[model samples]
Target: MPKIIYVDPDGTRHVVDAPDGTSLMQAAVANGVEGVLGECGGSAMCATCHVYVDPADGGRLPELGADEDEMLDSTASPRTTASRLSCQLTASEDLDGLVVRLPEEQI
Candidate 1:
């Protein structure tokens, strides 16, 4: 299991053990981590699962795919270089300490 660290807008951190192959959004929603609504159920059609990979992760995450890049443009919160659609990244042993920060809101 990969230990994902989810930091909410107000700085609350929820450490979750995510199963391999599980999407970050799916794990967060299943764990009741606040700030990740995942309204589209891991689809890139909505920005509800928007999250920012901590820059400190240092390229541990794979580059975002086209669909993820496109939907992020619709996020309710301003997107930064770190912005990513949580559904796009699969958890695995290589990403054991991945940290993602949640925005104040999501559209």
Candidate 2:
């Protein structure tokens, strides 16, 4: 299992175990990490799981697919180069210590 750190807007952090092959949204939802609504259930159809990957780890993730790219524009927070939908992030040993920062709001 890989460990992912979800940092909320208030600067609080929730570290959770992310089983390999599961999406980041699934890991967060399963662990009850606050702020990651995942309303689309890891479908990449909603921006509710919007987060900013730590710049250091951004290059390690796969490029966003079309669905996630489109939905990111609809997030409550400002879109950024680091912005990504958790639904599109799969947990793997390569992402063992990934850190993602949650936006102030999601809708």
lDDT of each: 0.90, 0.91
Q: 4-69 in candidate 1: lDDT tens per residue?
A: 999988889999999999999999999999689888788799999999987878488888788988
The lowest-lDDT stretch of 10 consecutive residues in candidate 2 is: 40-49
Where does model 2 exceed 4 Å of error? Answer: none
Worst 10 contiguous positions by lDDT, candidate 1:
53-62
RMSD of each predicted structure: 1.0, 0.8
CA lDDT for candidate 1: 0.90
Give TM per candidate.
0.95, 0.96
Where model 1 places Cα greater than 4 Å from the true spot, the runs are none
Cα error of candidate 1 at position 85, Å:
0.4
Residue-level lDDT for 94 in candidate 1: 91
- In model 1, the Cα lDDT at residue 73 comes to 94
